[model samples]
Target: MHLQEWLQLLCSHTGLKGSESEDLWSLLPSLPSFSLSTSSLLGLGALASLTAYWLVTRPRPMHPPCDLQAQSVAINGDPNCRRSALLKDENLLEFYYDDIRTAYDMFQRGVKITGNGPCLGFRKPGQPYEWISYTEVAQKAQWLGCGLIAKGCQLNTQQFIGIFAQNRPEWIITEVACYTYSMVLVPLYDTLGMEAMVHITNLAEMTVVICDREERATSLLENKEKGLTPKISCLVLFTDFSQAFAERAGKCEVEVLKLEQILDLGRQNLKDPVPPQPQDLAVVCFTSGTTGKPKGAMITHGNIASNASSVIKILEGSFTFQQGDVSISYLPLAHMFERMIQLSLFTFGARVGFYQGDITLLMDDMKTLKPTFFPVVPRILNRIYDKILGSVTSPFGRALLHFAVRRKQAELRSGIMRNNSLWDKLVFNKIQASLGGNLRFALTASAPISSTVLSFLRATLGCLIFEGYGQTECTGGCTFSLPGDASTGHVGAPLPCAMVRLEDIPDMNYFAKNRQGEICVRGPSVFKGYLKDPEKTAEALDSDGWLHTGDVGQWLPNGTLRIIDRKKNIFKLSQGEYIAPEKIENIYVRSVPVFQVFVHGDSLQSYLIGIVVPDREVFVDWAKEQGFVGSYQELCQNPDVKNAVLEDMRAVGKEAGLKSFEQVKDLYLHPDMFSVANGLLTPTLKSRRTDIQKVFQQQLSSMYNKTAS
Candidate 1:
């Protein structure tokens, strides 16, 4: 049956007459009832029905398994189903879960878990690398957990431990120790300013803090005047403590320990067993608040374990990992996505490679590790694609490159590559070399990447760049685009353990067919609740346990998910027509020549905009080649540059199928780009819309007031 027909049938049979008022309660009447005595029977019946449906609808392999080990359990049922069940059952001994408890247990069982590795820990230009194996990690955690207990860390209750540090092995060690001690790990983004850092630390009521270096120690010490709580009694650094530096600090004083000192304590207390439950609160990761202050989302061990197992199962069929796969760690571990990925890597016993310092050396690190998997934001992929396009020297070269891209895209769509064209081996070979030539898969999130970018990546790289969608509240990944199921612009199917439903706000002007609406999710991976904010927590999680994701999304025909924009980012024009700034901004930014677009005009008749940071290098080269002489600044202000940019915007707008009202009527170009230091972007590189609006308020007003050319 056709997709529309299937949807219509489901709607009709389920009594969902329209998008509005499609309540599950209305459909419940047609289902079987259950009394206390018959509830088990009813559940079994429902499970059987679901299994049958899955067997009929789920995708099957073209070739049957020759060996039993090669065959995976079906999504529905089979003999291997018991193995799958054992993997998910919390009570089962065979359950190899992904959580701090599992990590601790693995360490106790003599697994060589390394805290400091050549890739992630402290490294100098020409020094011998230092590392701490799994036994040491377990030993250190036991001591730290014991130290916390000795220093008044209690059990079966919520306690906070602030982890303030850069990406380091000690960060994970501290977090694991917190879990072992039944304390909540509050991960603070190291790049956060003093105010946010203090606010979160205090809000979480952190009793102890583990700092990565002297800089974090100084931040905490300097900010002590703002009233440090008595509960926070310890300040430990990964580096050796300096008594002189410690004496300079004044606040609610606490005992300080160096990394080695803490480990020494743990080593002495190695015989003690860690105390924690599967249901205990494990970590409190903060959300990236684009609109307001970041909120701490409480995640439990069960949540982590369930989510990780579900992800592992989904990836098992395609992306298999052995005992020692290589992963390069760079993304902030404070972010839930990175944290989840780290846990997965550790649980799978993968070798993690750390970058030198920042993303500038990511290419070098990728070459060093030759990693099989990496997580990145869309900006990184887009930049790489731009660089690839920029390298082409002639019209014929560009044509051949485009031809290779198109053919490769066709192969991806058709899943058959009968024609082994020479162009792929010759022209695309260089593109593959740029990414270290060993990238198997990449996971993109934090923003929407353009279909053009996604297509280019898959074609040239010969690997699937899986697009995942989730937020800090959902533990970073809720949906992922599967291999061979690539869509032009979809986030992909709902992950195995997640249930997704769109709540249509038809009264609002932005609703589209299977399109824009609040994305609601119910899954084990969802947060327990927002910390210390019950009202906000209630507002986000409904009574039925569905988390209102706040972002708007649509289900494509192929069951892939497409994120349109954040519901909060949508602003109305004078005509009451809402404009999704992110969608529009993504369209403009993907034009290759444009960079950093901000769409504004909250009360204007039509949207007016200002864009900053053009691809000056690319455009300047183009201008010089065209015999247009002047500096980049002179060229930016040149009539030709303005005309070219405006034309590019129009072309992109038309291609994206945006309406006239949604298009940018007038725009002002800024010479400088937004950056972390400029207070224009978040640490994660997301535009601070409110801050941008306030900063460019005058420029925006002028653009709107002035008539378009």
Candidate 2:
């Protein structure tokens, strides 16, 4: 029987009417259909008959001891719920079991979970909006899960399936289906060059890879040339490949399956039992590998589910929204941060609208969705802040505006007004209008954001922009600043059920007090281990299960955590003075019109050197205002431009209280900014320090070659 027919029969038998029946019926249109043998049909009929009998004879309402109302708790200092709410339930494994079962429950409860939208790609443009719904998502996941089972995917052992692609519905569906089947998903950044891609694939021992498009399909197929191909028996393409690439891929001697084909195979057998418990590994997200080859962090279903549940609980306390709140999902799903947030949205039954394309079109997409929530990285926020500040052309106007902003920010911090000021309304109201004016929070991560930008957002946007801290191993968020706790440079307290402690390294000066040291964490949200890398896994996670985060951090008196710098990135100069370059660079980047900044002084005698990308428009405008008659190219090499940056750097250094040896003394201008496309940055937009050091090795050497000549 079709899903609609089955739903009709069930609803009629139950006497469901009014809004309840309508709600249930709305969920049916998107469900997938399947063919069953007479015997199997009889068996399912018997189960359904029993279910209906129980429903009719059992208690009315059939509500659990707990409900959504009980789940709502204030995230920012509400004493009532925080004092009484339980973090975990009776079952030890309940956390893991919740991941897949909750999804099924939500579907049964008439939630619209997923949709198909117009491909609306970045590289390709001019496509109309096409969409897929939640029913389609659930059915497709079951189909894909069944297909994997049919293909002899091991129920035991570490079976890895790689998704080497960009953001798409297929990526999310495949991951969900894999979770249902207890298969570990390995998500690879599409921007990874061949070497890194091959290294990660081999390390994970992925047997099947779901490529996002023909480009990724071709890249993975060509990996055979590097002699790195292992038991990778299947290559599934999420997009249709050209006949030319297909023919060439066929020559490579690997079997290829289109995404639709796999889904079709699975849909043919939809009633198969859901496999595995939630504690089972669900994904293996690779680290950015700033130091070396990336290691696959084994994030389990329980870890993901727990994190999502925690975030949902926290969000409910501050925001008032129902099962169908809207969100715009544009960040890469490959990242743990986005994945966790997306999962949380699913649990809440939010309508997730995909961005039309890159962030350049994010505002346009926002206008369409009028999203209540937005997840972004610091780079995007920094750019927005810069653009807003740069718009004030007159120096006097800028000073007056900054003064008003500061006063308004102080008023906001003091809880004077929860809304925008009159001056702010007059000045920056259009800025708010551009964002659809429905934004509840701007969630930022991936790097430390500046206080100036954060303050400006809160004061002007009249919405909280919370900062969160986590790694791939922690299933996204370990700590998040509460809406009311938007203090400068604070990452906030650890989430409930998460245990964090610092391991003091005496040699590290930053960790000298307040239990400052390498941040080590142990929690239900922590990953199981690295995929097929026991040695590295052992090195990272201890026997007792604390994962050494490699980040130096300190706990403030208020219980918030502040990250000092990456342990590996802190270097000592020839004078034996340790320099935390990331901290210095972050400050300078905030103050200067630089798109990217890197500070280096390793083994150097005295001060630091910097490589910076000038904010082209701002730099040009500044040059024109200063009476410099030249183009951007000439301005880039002009002494005046260098002097401006140097002065800004010096000012920032003075404000930050840096010693002479720690200050930036020499600098170079970069013609281009670091980006994922150029192999200069990770997919997350973090600069690859090693790569940058190698590329600028000569220039770095030149800084010290003349002994201060």
Task: Using TM-score, give the best candidate's number.
Answer: 2
Model 2, range 1-709, lDDT digits (tens) per residue?
6556666787788786676567666765686676556786788678767765655543222121123223222234421112112345322122432434433343322233334322112223444334556666667778887887767676542778788776767777787677666677878886666777888888777778888788777778778645577667788888787888767666766678888888888777665546655567777788887777788888776777667655555555455444546667788877888777667666655656677547678777776666677888988887778778877879987987787778767766653434446766666677677776777667889889887788788777766677888888888877766545535777766665466667766666644344578887777788888777899899889999988887888766555677877776888888788877887888788555567888988775766888888887687776676677677778778867777777777787788887777778878877688887777888788888998999999888887774488
Query: Candidate 2: which stretches are off by over 4 Å?
Result: 1-129, 394-411, 414-425, 511-513, 624-627, 707-709
Q: Least lDDT summed over 10 consecutive residues: which range in candidate 1?
A: 62-71
User: What C-alpha lDDT, on a 0 to 100 scale, does residue 697 get in candidate 1?
Assistant: 85
Please, what is the TM-score per model? 0.80, 0.81
Candidate 2: residue 668 Cα off by (Å) = 0.5
Question: Candidate 1 on 260-316: residue-level lDDT in tens?
Answer: 776776566554564566566778888656666778898877667666666666666
Task: Give me the displacement of residue 679 in model 2, in angstroms.
Answer: 1.1
* Candidate 2 accuracy as lDDT: 0.69
Clashes of each: 4, 8
RMSD (Cα, Å) for all candidates, in order, is 15.2, 15.9
In candidate 1, stretches whose alpha carbon ends up further than 4 angstroms from where it belongs are 1-122, 126-131, 155-157, 228-231, 240-243, 250-252, 416-425, 510-516, 604-606, 622-628, 637-640, 704-709
Clashing pairs in 1: 113-134, 119-354, 120-354, 143-266
